[model samples]
Target: MNSLDTTRIRSYFDFPAAGRVVTNNAASTQPPRELIGLLQRCAPWYENVHRGQSTASRRTTAMYEASFDTIAAWLNAPGRGCIATYRNTTEAINAVMYSLLTDFRDGDNVVTTMLEHNSNYVPWHALCREILPRLGRRVELRLARFDATGRLDLDHLASLVDKRTKLVCCTGASNFFGTKPDLSKIRAIADAGGYPQPTGERRALLLVDAAQLAPTSALDVQALDVDYLAFSFHKMLAPFGVGVLYAKRHLLDHALPFLYGGDMIADGGVTTETVAWNDLPWKYTAGTPNILGVIASAQALRLLLDMVMPTAFFGGSGPLPRVAIEEVMARVGRHTANLTARCMAGLSEIKNLRVYGPEHRTPLVSFTIDGISPFAIAEALDRRGIEARAGCHCATLAHRALGLDPPATCRLSFALYNTPDDVDLATDAVRETVAGRRRAGRPRPGRAQVSTAAGRPT
Candidate 1:
């Protein structure tokens, strides 16, 4: 059963009235109506932040700046200096790649897992396979494997890290497999790899793509001891635009700016001979940011707390107590976990289907029927008013590594708002879809085929 009053939480969204069951939450969670209202609430005073002299600018700037604190507090980071916003998690991770580009020595390597979403894997791939090589650096990229049960092979991960390993990029939760690695254990392995940093630290830096974890769990960056962590606001009930990257304060202080332009420079500190960079975060924020989006994303977190709990503990702007965050997110984690368990149980009952990942997953299920096309399953589910996602879910590397011919699967990922009823509807759709395909023995044009079979699949 869900830990929160899901019926009441459903009231905060518009999907219920519209009869839309959004089970594809790993791609993006539905934004609450209140987040839209929050954006409307900021419409009047919305102005360029840090660049204007007007009162509206200062007011909007305060809200924008305060957004970072909310994000930092949500992750239990040291302070706002560690936070940097981007267009999405993909961009946020790419920023890390660029900022650390020059630091990679010729003989260095990066250790990442095959279970990573492309957002985490592709950036490192390009850094090692494409970009760094073009610059005359032959930095190697090593992939740690996941077992058939979808858990990261910690032993395999350990074997890949050594003194030459510079960074270890991992996914906190797998979008396709729904596996969650032991982050603390991963940290221990990363630290065991004694790479000499320019900062004199003898360890491989750790970067976690928290895209799946952040939406449901309360995370403590200090506790994880990760050097870099990235996640998208869209996965957590905010609008589609903003993503975040959290680094240690010293790292941000030392790394080069990802994108350099107008606002990132210190005021009048730019001379023709010497250009000064702006302080902590704005040094990373190059131009006019998604000011309204940042404010709304922060407000989304506040609204989330009020939705899950009995009281309004967070507001528009104030210090967000870590205790409050831990409480609210624990409820969210429990609710989603129950929904995922229900999904897994329902999917298990569907005949001739293979569900990926371990029993304890991060609120998602990806599976394939023996003879049905995954895309067709998604299409059939959509026709039933049950939203589902098909394709690799950008976990192309994992899908390919698993020996999937076309490298895809139909995925049903849950959130705090998902209900037991939603899981039934999704699995029922899949069961019926597979049954329908079986009845029609021959391949039809423009439809799913049991490509390996001449007739109906048993």
Candidate 2:
């Protein structure tokens, strides 16, 4: 298989010039210089959307609203009416929780997995434990466990769902485990549960947290048959502060809005007697939205394809070819997979280093050296100019389930811009850090006393 032209891709990012080895892509990818430039280009047309009659407001509104179309096309949703913007993946998932707050019956339940990030898990936890109980509802939140190798236990998940299950929320890819659950099988399980919803459906609604998956995969909400999907643009190449929630047309049409205020109401229809909501998507967009962020996030999707392939697709609008999207993402997935494999191979050679997740998984590896704190490992890697992340990575449940003392692991994740050499440098740094610790006697106790020596643990 051919590799991506990472040299050309690296040139588009400013991080390479600063001697930074950005391997923490699963957390957030570095924005390309062109994306930053695009933001500046929009400065001339600065105004709030859906407000005044001035040319600036009209132009900004057009661009901002068109952004919804671009995002819908990227996800292969039916249309822009199915899309709603949010601050991030956490907020997007919260929106779903709030929208269906009253719809959940007293005896109903929500089924999620141990492989989820807190963004997907915490909201349901709060709904079942804190919020709903206070409202005199006894909604149960069931958690499905993972296998010994860090894969989602399908049988365990199937056993958790029943007729009373209202929703099944799962992550498209696990941030800590790097495991991608088979969505089709999950959809089937959800359907077989025969849960009755207010919308006359007999199956539990499927909500996929695609935060980690969307950055490196081709996501089609229609093909997956997911009722709701959420992902953040910062994980891809876009700037921060923009996330998306794609729901079926009927759901958005019938489900209550998450927030209500200004623009969500119909034009001049806010009478004292009764207030009518706006159209499909506008009804979801309350207040003056993040106009510039939405536009930039849509453009980021275009720029991602252009960055992967040699052809230019930026500064355009309309539906992207599914074939083009698949081909580009396939190339990206293969490249990152190869880099991750190399890192795993190198890390496995080091003594007492325990790597989490399956050997073949997403383009990331989380591991810990025995007797060494992951925080110290991250700091040592930082001194060596390798940007990696440590902690539960918002995957607190999975880490605790694995019996990790501090519930943390040091993670090195890859992206399209990361080359094979970057993987080598990172793994080599880990080996050195571990070896230095062995030479310096036993590991020390406490956080402040941990060693920062290259290849050494505190």
Candidate 3:
């Protein structure tokens, strides 16, 4: 087994696990000491940024801008690309969707995949709704289907993407299945399909929601050749209320701002009120912005990068490409394999347990027992000192796609810090709960009933 120093990671998170299994990385990650220290150091400088003319405000503003530069370097975005700060991934998605809808005429279609997070799915779908009525032309929306293995159907995806498609929104990785779509292939498809004369044919702009990929792995924006990318720092072990939306500066120059406010408005007249927008990123990023959160997020990015540097994470002697996600996943797969083995072994002892998602999937496993509801399973595990996520983890459409309606299954996600022992403990708890229910010959009291929703399992 490829060993990970999970004890060290647990120490870093300061996990207060008196006992039982630990399984709570999917919701949010724990920031390291350095990031926490960075936040604490700047906590006192909470003056209003961009609004104040004072030196304190100036310092904060400078720091905030510097944070953007740091993030750009971390993402390896184009030198002139704009990194507009935002509230979260949802806001970033909104900005991009607004930009696309404002620029493109009606009847222009958006091609996305089933693997996308709701943040990526909702905005574009809403945009389609808004624009479809304006012109007689209908807005076409398509979802690239995934195979039974939960991997993207690349051939089908390519077939769906055509000249009418104005934008292709894809995720860097799936939060549900922990499947990293082959971005290199997606980029190739985009390059082949995108507009006019240069690369033989023109197609659609590729926008990647890197919310899941960026924190866990490095990205090369140029190499990917995507038109736009968005991610959140909160999921990357940074403080909340800070996310990034990166687009080629030229493209951003043409797009309309999603919101209009202080920092984004150049000037406005008092009379009938005429207003001019700011330049590039600042045009989209309205108001004072999340200065402290930005700074802290930058620190958080550095912390995660340091921990999973290409050399250490990838397990090779020669220098690994910092932005190669496949290499990282290959390494992570090794980690997952170890955990999976332990989990499967322990789960084998249990009767009537149904694990969801792809078999031989990542460390994450969404499952249900024959007679128990997801909530009961989560509660049972919680009482046993193990924590897991239950319910339709925000991907309502994904659940529907899986043919599961109403409440979802229990989702146990693993982090780099999670150990085989944790998996064993979790499996033990699950087995014990199943056995208890079976022996009692009755449904456990307070246990929830099976969901009546109608989506297929992914």
Candidate 4:
């Protein structure tokens, strides 16, 4: 199954066998069975990496290190040296925050936007509001606004960045709105801030939380020219537990390690008076890492390629071809985009249901009905065997910005394996749920029949 072949692609996963509708992919993609098997196979030989001399140890270490290379190629980064794995995107973003702790001077501000997931916003909030202030260095956290249509206010974002702005953080895609911001334009705005760095560059550093974008999009860090980028593998059909942080080599070389011990130290370079950190990527990787998760996550990317291409990549390892990567992701994007549109069209017919964001969105639709709680809607969908996510989706700020009374919405997100039928089912499920609510309450006979759409199958 290539990117366009959902029938073949869905075969690799166990979800279809179970007759499930997995529309909450923005939270996490269901793992394909081969990855689980690959993970299980590593159990017998699993050994602590980079510290032992045994054959099993060396083998694990080699595969572990090569996973970095695969991740780098996936992002079109310079090399493995730029990739650092973490538990998830949240921790990866926190890593950057800790690494830059002392870099913020008094009165300096970090400008982020209202569309951020709490993973992106909370860390900066704690850093500037809690951590830095107590240490007698007061840094400010500024939020740029988004419009009623869920489009980011780019002009407002630019105005938020000035000489005092040390870094600008933004989401590449909104998990709630499903809106993908123009990263190149955001990069230009960040550069225009022109905050002088210690390295002599005159620009505020830009960090992107790409948790929502990386699944279907081909993310080229070089092309984006972002200083730092973070994304989680769980959202990309890889099993949970691994995320990646891509920083410019120079920034990694200069910044202090967020966590220090074990492998992060230079092999024999630790001394009482002086200590040397390891090379580019490892300098940031401290302690015994999530070995199996990293390796399997890398293979997950390979499996994605194999699903999209006539040939296979999961059977092999190392750098993926850039052209193939681009083609595969574009195909996946187009497929999911079509599915989202279809889902929206089916959803639009329902009375009192309102979808968020502009017409063009990522592979997700978040919406709410006037009289129903989103949580209640999600529970009703669950009874129908459909998987939908409710509440803020960790985008509390975006919800609050929209003046959502309870600050929540029901969201249906898609992946490569999601079918048009799945979208229709989810949308129909929402319609039925809304119709059910009307029947239980004070029902208008005419609107009730219309809402329930008795002509359609329940």
Candidate 5:
């Protein structure tokens, strides 16, 4: 049980107007002081790394490689596993897709779920579109459906896997509902020789996209039996432009590199005609890497593991355990049977509102006020100094699937920093917005009238 100091946590971020009433731990997060200082120190040294003959370039390259070691430690990956520093999760996913396609044949299938962010979806879909035709093969996209509560239907996943299945990819925690998938169970099902299905296939490799889960909890790869895992630094409290991909050693050696360029070779020296390739990390890094961001990421991770343990690290109950970190999260989960309960509890008082996503959810929720466009809702909140996001959230498929009209949903995500007071402010702002619109007597098309004070629509 770690004792969390809310006051100390409060001092770290730059809150918005209205004394920072609007807060979110989604999209990205505020890094520590040391991360800022580290970036500031390296700002000027942003010259091309590994290309120069100078001592400074050599030192920078060393720092860059050292960052991989730090990332490996944080991820608890095998020492032999190759760590490729990427621009972001998108690039890493692309690399993985391409590399997997190099070895996997047309008959081989890779399984993913509906829960994936676009970052994980697009690359593979692109491969399926472009490569499947060439090889005369078919790629199957399988989703493990969830119940009304957003818990993954493991039984559904078990039904999908067969001998041809080569890779199984899934998100550790859902960004939409904050639902945590049971990876251990997934791994076991995949690896079990006697697969439930009629096919006599053994286990498939497991790839976890831990982008959302890593920030809130410690991810022990060995414990989870994950073969490959990828995540970004910016989401975890560092700046953007840097990401990490942990691929088991055998996979690294067998997989092909996505981008081809200078550093990724053993020797690209031109003797009128000569070219060779470099090893693991270098092979995948095609251009001048984001040295400063990589350094900052390494430093930021160290800071989180060291200084910010209370809120980000420790989890339990009571004074000894820290309420804001663990206990509150538990209460939030318990307070509502699902996302619908939790969000409705907060927004039921607000007139003309509709919540989106499964009733069972994570700390994040998206909703829309009746007859209000998402953009208008966001602007209204901004006027009241309530910070929120309005857009597709890079999930066009999900929006289309949900049959959303008028516009995209307005998103408000919670983190350890968010208090119950924050929820109250957000709910009140929605109520005020709806009431103010009604007072203006503007007819909201396809929208129903309701009493705000009564909480739910009469």
Candidate 6:
């Protein structure tokens, strides 16, 4: 497989200059200097969209609205009407829940999986357990289990879906296990449920949390046939605070607005009798939106193509071709997979280290040492200038299901800009930390006292 030019890609970001190994990409990626520069270039045109008649308003509104088109083209959506912006993935999923709040029937259930992040799971959990119950609805929240290898148990997931299932929420990829579930299969399972919806469809809606999947994979929303898909741009080299929720155009038209205010209403169409909502995409975008963030985030997608391919596609405004997107992301997947393989191979040489998930995974690895706390291992790696994450990573259900008390693991994730040398440096740091602990006679503690420094049990 061909690899990305890591040297050239690294030069686009300022992090590498500080000698930082940014392995926590699953949480968020380092923003390119060009995206920062793009933010500055957009400063002079700053104005609220759909609010005023000034030139700045017209210019900024055009760019902001065009951003929706760019994002829609990135995901191969029908149009910008199907797209909605949010603070992050968590808020995007929450918007879905709120929009469909009154749609759930008394006996309907929502099927989810242990492989989902908390962003995907918690909202449904709250919907069924907390919110719906008070409204005299006994909606069920069913959870599918994962297999020993951390893969989503397809059979278990199939059993959880039935005619009464209203929605099936699953992660496109596990941030902890690094496992990318077969979304097509999940979509089929959701379809087989045959639940009648207000839109006259007879299939359960499928919502995919693509926070991890979108960064390294070519995700075509129409090809996947997902009812809704959400992801954060920060996970794909954009500045924090911009995420996308792509739904079917019809779904957006029928579903109620999550947040109702300001520009969401029709232009001077509000009155004491009734307030007509605005057009598609705009109705979902309530209030003064993040004008600069949306433009920068959309440009970040363009910059990502340039960073991966040996070409210049940034600083332009137009539709990104599906062929170019597929080729660039395929190269990114291959490079990160290679790095992950090397890192896992090197970690296997360490005695008593237990890595989670399958041998082939997305671009990250989470593992635990038999005698060492994950926090201590993370701290030691930090001392060696290796940045790693130690926590449940919002995969709390998966960690708890695996019987990990306090529910945490140390993770080292990679991005397109990370090189093989970065993987070697990380694994070597792990080896030295383990060996040093052994030489220091640090005995393994009992379960009762084997707590994380944050006081969570391990």
Q: How close is candidate 5 to the true structure, as a TM-score?
A: 0.80
Error of 5 at 205 (Å): 2.0
Compared with the true structure, the alpha-carbon lDDT of candidate 2 equals 0.92
Off by over 4 Å in 6: 442-458
lDDT of each: 0.90, 0.92, 0.70, 0.91, 0.67, 0.92
**Per-residue C-alpha lDDT of model 5 across residues 45-116, encoded as one tens digit per residue:** 656677888777877777777777667666666652468888887788878888777556656666777667
CA deviation > 4 Å runs, candidate 2: 442-458
Instruction: Order the candidate numbers by lDDT, best to worst.
Output: 6, 2, 4, 1, 3, 5
**Candidate 6, 190-309: lDDT as tens digits:** 999999999999999999999999999988999999999999999989999999999999999999999999999988888999999999899998888887888889988888988777
**Model 2 over residues 1-458: C-alpha lDDT tens digits?**
35799998899999999999999999999999998999899999889989889999998888888888889888888889999999999999999999999998888999999999999999999999999999999999999999988999999999999999999999999999899999999999999999878888899999999999998888899999999999999998899999999999888888899999999999987988998999979999999888888999999988988888766778777678878888888888899999989999999899999999998889999999999999999999999999999999999999999999999999999999999899999999998898778878653565344557754543
Which residues of candidate 5, in runs, are more than 4 Å off? 1-3, 14-22, 43-48, 192-202, 267-276, 309-345, 348-361, 442-458
lDDT of 2 at 373: 97
What candidate 1 gets wrong by more than 4 Å, as runs, is: 313-315, 442-458
The stretch of ten residues in a row with the least summed lDDT in candidate 1 is 449-458
**Could you estimate the TM-score for every candidate?**
0.95, 0.95, 0.83, 0.95, 0.80, 0.96
- How accurate locally is residue 130 in candidate 1, as Cα lDDT from 0 to 100? 92
Clashing pairs in 5: 177-362, 190-203, 264-278, 265-277, 265-278, 266-277, 266-278, 339-359, 339-360
Residue 22 in model 6: shift from native, Å?
1.1
* lDDT score for candidate 1 against the true structure: 0.90
**Pairs in steric clash, model 2:** 432-455, 433-455, 433-456, 434-455, 437-456, 451-458
lDDT of 2 at 47: 90
User: Which of candidates 2 and 4 is the stronger one according to lDDT?
Assistant: 2
Candidate 1 structure quality by residue, lDDT tens digits, 50-114: 99899999998988999998888888898899999999999999998999999999889999999
| Top-scoring candidate (lDDT) | 6
lDDT (C-alpha) at residue 42 in model 1: 76
